[model samples]
Each structure stands twice: as C-alpha cells, then as structure tokens.
Target: MASPAPTSAHTGRHLPHPVLVISVVVAYLVALHPGTLPRDAMTTTVVTTGVTALGAVIGMLLARWVSRRHGQPDGQTRRVVLGIGVLVAAGGAGLAVWWQNLIRAAVGAVPVGPDWWAGATLAPVAVVAATVVVPRVTAVIAAAAVALTAGLLTPASAGADEGQPLPRTVSESGTLLRGELSAPEFERPATRLVKTWRGADGLSARAVIVAVPTGSGWVDPAAVTGFVDRFGADVRILALPYADVPSWQAFISDDAAATESSIALVREVAEVLQGRPAGDRPLLVLYGQSLGAVGADAARTWLEDRHPGLLAETVLTAPPAETVAAESDSPRVVVANRTDPVIRWSLSSLWRPATTPDGTVLGGPRVPQVPWLPVISFLQTSVDLLAALDGPTGVGHRYGVEQAHWVTGLPR
Candidate 1:
C-alpha cells in the first residue's frame, strides 16, 4: 500500500519556515540599502529581526526540552502545543508594544514611527516559525541570519573628527580650546575640547566634561553647554572625546584605551591648574554622562590622591550601575533616572546590595514611580533608553535641561 499523504496540520507547520527565511533576507537587504528605507527604519528592522528570531529560538528550545522530559505527544497534541507557542509569542509582541506606548506616554517621547509596526508584524511570524517549522536546523539558520544581519548593518561609531582647528585663546564668547594628546598606549591621537567661558575679569571655575556619545559617536553639545551654564558665565568647560568608532560595540571594546586617555587628559588639566596662582586658579569640577561617566569615575582615585583639593565637585549623569564609587574629598553627585534601563537593569545593581553612601544619589525629574521588579524594570528600562535617543530634553535619559537642578548645590 502507498504511504499516506501528510496531514493539513503538518503542511501548515512547514509553511512558515520558507516565509521566515524570505523575510529575514528581505529585511537584511533593506537594511543594507540606505535609500530603500529611512535610517531609523533600517535600524528598527535590524533590531526587530534579531530580537524576534532570538526570542523564538529560546521559546522553541524550552518547548523541546519540556517535551523530551515529559515524553513526545501525538500529532493532535503537538498541534495544540504549537498553537499555544504561537499565542504566547504573539502575546509577548503585544506586551512589548503596550509597554513601549506606556513609556512614551509617561515621558512624551517621540513616536518610533511606522517601522516599529513593520517589526511588530514580523516578530510573531518569526516566533511561529521557531515552534512549528520541521527540520529544526532551518530555524537555527534563520535565527543566525537575523542576528548576523543586524550586527553587520549597525553603524560602528560617529565616523571622522570635526576637522576644526583648536582654539588658541579664550574669548569673551565661549571658545573651544582643542589639543592632541599622544601616548604609547593609545592607537591614535586623543583629541580634547575645552569650551572656555571667560568674563571681563577672568575664569571663575573650570569644568572637565567627559562626553557621552550616541552609538554613532555623536555627542550632544547642548548637554555639555547646559552643565557648564549652571556654573554661570565664567566657567571653562573641558570636553573629552570618548567614542571615536562607529558602533557601541567598538566603544565598549575600546573602553580600556578610552579610560587611559581620560586619565591622561585629567592629569594634563590638573597640571594646568597647579601652575596657576592659588588665588587666580579657577574652582575645578569634573562632569560626565553615560559612557563618559565610566571614564570620569576611573580617574577619580588618581585625582583625589595626587591633588586632594583640586576637584571641588563631580557630577555624573546616567552613569552605568557597574561604576565603583571612589572615595574623594570632593563632593560626588550621581544623577540617575529610575526609568532609565541602563541604570535599572545594570548587573551591579541587580547582583549587589546598595552600598553607595547616603545623599550621593539624586532622583532625576523623569524617573517613574513604579514598584521595582527586576523583569518588569528590565523591559521598561530597555524601552526607556531607546525612547531617550530621540526624546526631548529632560525626559527619559536625556539630562540637558535638568543639569541645573542636579548641579545647583555642588561647590563651585
């Protein structure tokens, strides 16, 4: 007798595999071609593809492991299991969307636009493919493709330098003092920017601002300016470049080099201050934001030991949770938004108990007043960081407008 034809459910189970493979390829191509889609759209596509594919793979693996331990089920039972998997995946996608919307509403964040919808639609398909597709190897391949495409398409750093000549002298209007620092440890010349605000008399204070760049290495000048303005018209602002590469991965890889360069720059500034007359010297302050905060924190110990009273105050905004608190004579203020994912979902905060001294932490204006649950906070915080990228000042993780509030009580 001839073999029986496959059941409709079996045929249906196999259909999503080809569809998923095609979708992955198309998404990758769209991301690769700049004009085909907007830059944000491309990013959204890559992120969605990777996230969905990974989530689906994890779900499928868990389901299979459960089945092996419990014994394999009959065809009808398997079909039911697959249906549940699909429903769960769809539910997760829905939950992510709803959570993101909630965050946007709370912060008045810029809408993520239509590309988010496109990704939302594709996410469920990817999840369904993982659970129902036969020849499990195909599902693995699809997942890998999604991940690789996303990684390759993402921009590495902000690209080339501004190429402007460093200012030679301080002016009535703020002037950007630029210089190059070379060291054996660093691969390239470490560039620095000092925006000096000099009044008719002279400098009253000096602020060394370590910049936090976007994934593309673009720093928000407004953030630096706002921080400096809090100290009044006669404060000199020193801006250091941390992210020179194209992507966040490159910035992370170069962390050691960046830290070394930051320490060197801080030493240089300290020496400049030491040479000035005690009465004439400007009150010294150190400031950093996000990734820049890591570099600034790394230099704290050396600054305190070598020049005890050199730094009057230190301000850190949205610093990573892993940052070790260094003891310094100078007052240290850490500014964080409770809604910020980077701070809330940090491994240091999660694994370690609170050991930071009292009064060191200042609540940001935009932090949500929700109960702290690890899983929920992780999801919300991740979306918070994304929303912050294009969100308005003082909302979410952006601290340009709230700089005054955080720095007001600090010594000048």
Candidate 2:
C-alpha cells in the first residue's frame, strides 16, 4: 500500500530548500542589472528565464554537494540557512538597486526589471527544476552569474561596413592608382592605391593614407576615397579594405589582432617608402576614426620612433584617453564630441567622473549634466558606447565627411 501523505515526507516541495530559495532570489535580483539599452518586455522575460534556468542548475549542484557531505538537512537547519542567505543577498541587492536607480535618474530612464507576474510564473519553474535534481533540502546556497552580450552592434562599434558606397569619381577617369601598397594578409583588398600629382611644392609626390578600420577585421574602400578625393591629384591613398569579417569579439578583444595587422601594414608601407630616394618617396599619412583612430595613432608612434619624419599627417577622431594620453603634447588632430562615451569611458571612470580640461577636443555643446555615482557611472557609460554613433553627424561619435580638411590644408 502506498502512503497518501506526500507532504509529510522529507522532500522540500512546499517549502523550498535553502539553496533553491537563495538561487531564485539572487537570480531575479541580478536580472535587475542596468543594461545599456532599454529592453522590451519580451527581452526581459527571455533574459529572466535564462538567468533563472542557470541559477537553478547551480542551486541543484550545491544541494547535491551538501546532501553528500551531511545528508538531508532538517527543516530547522534549512530555515536557518535560508535566513542567513536571504539577509546577505538582500543587503547586497539593496545597495546595487540603489545605485542602479541612481543611474536611471541620471540617464533620463525609468526603473527597469522583470515584472512581478513573470517572476511569479518562471521562478517556481526554476525552483521545481532544482528540487527535481535534489529532492531533499540542503544548506549550501548557489550563486548565479550572468553574462550579457550584444546580438547587433553598429558598424562604428563592430568595425564593420555593411555597405560602403564609393564616390562616382573612383570609377571615372584618372581613378587614382592601385596596388601601390599591400598588407601580408589573406584579405580580398589589402590596400587602396593612388597616383601621384604635383604637390604645392611644385614636385610630383604621393601621400599614402592608411585607414585603420576601427578594430574592424574588414576594411571599407570608401574610407580611402573619402580622403583621396580631398587630395585632388597630390596623394596616393593606401587605406585597407581587408576581407576579414568584423564581430563584437574583435571590437572588445584587448589584443585586437586586426588592428595590430594594420600597424604591421603601415610599417611595411613605411619601409618600402623609406627605400625610395628622399625627394621621390611618397609621403605617409595615417587617418582613422574611433578604434581606427587608436590604430592610426599607434602607427604614427611606431613610424616616429623608428623612421623619423616618415609620417606626414595624423588625424585621430574620438580617441580614448587611454590610447592618446590626456597629458601628452602631440600634433595629432583629434575630433571628439563632448559626450562621446568612447572617448570618456575607462576603468577609472568607476571612481573619477569625466571632466573637460581647457581646450577639449572638438568640443561640442554640452549635453545633460547629470550627477555621477561610482559604479553607476561606469555602467551608464558602458551602455552609452553601444549607441554612441546613433546621433547626428556632428554629435556623439560621428565626426562627418569633411575629415580631410585638417590634413589636406597642411603643407605637404
């Protein structure tokens, strides 16, 4: 005969085990993380479900460990464990919530998180799943860790150019030259080419402009033309339009092998140009925006260090202070919007807020003046990077098409 009283059994069905309860609590609490962009209801639900599912797995593992170590915990022991876990979790969550809410107020956003109804529905499913893995209650509580990733990123962020339109002149007459420079890579178009013309000095010379494709694995040929057209007939453009595909991994990775390759390409170009007679050698110019700008600056630094006087131009748009130190004195031209997060965000931002020194680069009108809180400021800036180029051409991180004036107007 089977017993009818399943409730009286030692299973923690009605009353969740300490590990299960704490996992659910911490899971939902972490789901409140203030992300960069505002997510819709469906996104929140999907994210919450994933987080809950992950938390449940960890909770089950901890419960299993405890069961093996000390057998099934009694109801009193479970209650005590739950009390301590809940208190600690609640205290930390309280501080995080306060900071997140502060960020919401600063960024002109409302509080965001999973809804109560959704939590009520999915949380139990997660708990039940955990309980299935370990039928008896245990004292060990599980900690859930979640990693947020972007499904889509802008070309500026990812160093990807979906469609780069070339100027009509590129197909028309004189069409500059091709194959004057190249990178040692398996890319479709390693570098753009250009023909030489009479410079203001009454001498026929070429200027090779290397476009650092912003942490991008691939290159945009149109970027070469953007500056090439400005040269009229005096420069040869050697911008890279490599065939490598760009991804967020390439964008965030510290090593950024693509960027390093660009530096190597620049070095190769300089070595070849240096081999030419002093007066006949083509002038080298480095131009890039955002991550490209960082690469451009590094290329110039290398050239200046080894082949002094090899570089003729340096245009770095919206470079982060980390790349180009805030204290350095260099002739490099930097065009940066006042609120461009790419230029401002850093690890130090967690403690120090961004301040405008005298002569802020290409300083535009100031945006919202919000109070900065430690961790909240860092989180806010992190998300701001995603939407940095969503604004007008002159605002945020977009510097527009007239970037060649600074270089073109210089004496060559």
Candidate 3:
C-alpha cells in the first residue's frame, strides 16, 4: 500500500492522494463562498479555516480507507488522477470565488478597489495556495475549532427546551431590504395613514392594517399590495409620521419619539372608526418588523388597555431583545427563524435557546442543528446581526408577504 503526499508534491516514495488533497482544498474555497449574506473579513477567516481543517481530517481518514481496500494507483493512473484533480480544483475554486462576487454585485457592495477585475486571477492560484499546509497542522487546527464550537454551544444549549413565555426574529443577509415609498401626512400634523388598498368596489374592507415599516422606517409598496392581493380585499392603511426616524436605530437607542408616534398613529386609526360600533368596525391590526414590531406590540397593549377588543390582530417580525406584556386574547404572530441571530441574541439567550415559531408564518428553524452555547452563541449571533438584512426575502429581517400571510390564515 502507498501512503499519502501533500498537494504541492508528488515527490518521494508516496504520492498525494488526489481525492484527499482535492477535497480539503475544495472545502476551504467553498466555505469562503458567500451564503444568503456576505460575511466580514474576520468571520470569513474563521469560517474558512475551520471548514478547511475539518475537511482535511475527514479526507485523510477516507483516503486511508480507500488505500487499504483498493491500494493506491501507480504510474499512469497516479499521474492521471493528480492531473485531473489539479484541473478540477482550479475550476471549482475559481467558480466559487466568481459566484461570491456576483452576490456582491447584486447587493451593490463597495469593491475593495476600483480595479476589482484584477482579483479574478487570484482564484486559480488559490488551488495551489490552499493545500500547502501539512495535514498534521490542519488536524491540530481542527481540534481547536471544535473546542471553540463546543464552548459556545454550551451556553446556547442551556435551557433550550424549557420555555413558557411566547415568541420573538434568520439567515445571514448582507444585502439590505431597500424600499422606495412616499410618506405624505394626512390631515393631522406629524401623523399620517395612507390607504394602500381598497376593495374593487372602492368602498369597503373587512379590516384595516395599522402597518409600520421595518427598522428602516420606509414602508414597502409590495407589502401593501400583499395584504390586498393575498386576502382578495382589505383596506391596507400604513402608519407613518411626517418626519420619519430610521427604524433600525430603535434597537440601540430608545426612540421614545418614534414609539410615541406609533402610539399616536394607532389612536388616529381608532378615531377613524369612532362612530361605528365595536362589532361593526373593521378589524384593526397593528403590524411591524424588528424595532417596528416591538413598537407595534407596545402600541397594541396601550390601545387594548383603553379600548378593549379594538385590535384583533397583531403581527410582529424580527422583534428585538424583549416582548411587551399584554392582557388580551388577540391573535398575533412572532415570526422567527432558528438561524436568525437577531432573535437568538439577548441576555436571556446566554442561557436560553430561541423558541421555535408556533404556526405557519415562516415557522421552523433555518439552521436547526446549530446548538446554542452560552456566551459563545451570544457572540456568534451578535456577529451575525451585522449583515442580517442581506438574507433573501422572508429571511433574516427581509420579511415580505409571509408576515401578512400568517395573519390571513388565522381565524378572523
């Protein structure tokens, strides 16, 4: 039987196992490839190095097994395998790099330099560069990575199953969910509620949505269309203030002004239906996402306290660290994704794992197997929050129709 060699050499008595060397190198490049979101340099480095080393160890074991059963190829077979591997590796590495750039382009990411095309040549060179590290070195590195992973998951796994409190937030997303909608005020100063949809007859609706925008504070036109298109008919009302505050900031800063504006918007909605009896009034739903979602919950609580049974539905997406307390049997949705670091992050998440979404509104874990480790999960998830909006639609903070879809499905 023949022993394995490094990717850089076919010299000495043992030749490199083409499969083993190729597998590890391929894995490193693939891991570097962007996911639903882009990663920063530090995260890219951590991810690539960990995956590369782990793949190397697995490749070594598999190669050894193949050698024991079938023996290593020699002469022409050996040379051919090595040649083919080099070609394949070069192609695969280049492809993965190019694919990531395409994603960057889609998101309008600023290039490292204006001479971006110059980086194209580096892909093929990576095939050679990737495998220069000795297998033993990679094996050691893999051990360290495993230890790190375990340490972080320890905190995440604690109290993961024990839960009594109701929900909260996805995939990694580097792209921002951008929207272009005008925010013109109504008759009231600083307060506005635009009618996004009306029945075909142009006179009726079953309910009205006091919808707030995502953290960016700009309502998405598609979302307005969604409520009407999905449900066949409903008057879609978007809540806004004349001078909008960026919604994402609500996470770090206590924007009492914005929260109060949201409260005022709900009150205006109630006034519009003042003369009608409670049973005859169109169902009022307070809806929001991220910080907006948090505000919606708070506003609902305030409204319910003053006028019971006014808010029949409340939908929140990607709410931050805490949930508001309410005293009502109103139906609501706390859309959450297992992979969403935003929902997974909090002081409580240091020991308690994220709760799963209850019903169909984008429920279930996007990355269910990743266990939560105490401080580690918190830190890792915190990093994930950087590019949270970059994920695809309905992922991370880029929710679309699903937010309303879940509400429409519920018994109204």
Report the C-alpha displacement of residue 264, candidate 2, in angstroms: 6.7
Clashes of each: 7, 1, 17
Those runs of model 3 whose alpha carbons end farther than 4 Å from true positions after fitting are: 1-42, 46-203, 242-246, 326-328, 354-365, 408-412
lDDT of each: 0.49, 0.54, 0.52
| CA lDDT, candidate 2, residue 83 | 74
Q: How accurate is candidate 1 locally (lDDT)?
A: 0.49
Which sections of candidate 1 miss by over 4 Å? Answer: 1-71, 74-97, 109-123, 134-173, 181-219, 240-243, 275-277, 326-328, 344-388, 408-412
Residue-level error in angstroms, candidate 2, position 23: 3.4
Residues 1-412, candidate 1, lDDT per residue (tens digit)? 9999987545555322322333343333222221101124445554555555554455455555665787544455545555654565455556545555555556655555666766656643554455446537756776687677655553212222354222233222252333333323322333223323222222454444434333223444555566556655545555444444533454457655446756766776677678878677776666666666666666666688898877766666665555546454567777765444444435443333333432356444432244444343443344334434444455445556455346644544
Residue 150 local lDDT, model 3: 55
| Model 2, span 183-253: residue lDDT tens | 34413233222222222221244566666665443333434555656666666544443323343344465
Among all windows of ten consecutive residues in candidate 1, which has the lowest summed lDDT? Answer: 30-39
Q: How high is each candidate's TM-score?
A: 0.64, 0.53, 0.52
Candidate order by lDDT, decreasing, is 2, 3, 1
**If candidate 2 were superposed on the true structure by all CA atoms, what would the RMSD be?**
8.7
Candidates 2 and 3 compared by TM-score, better number: 2
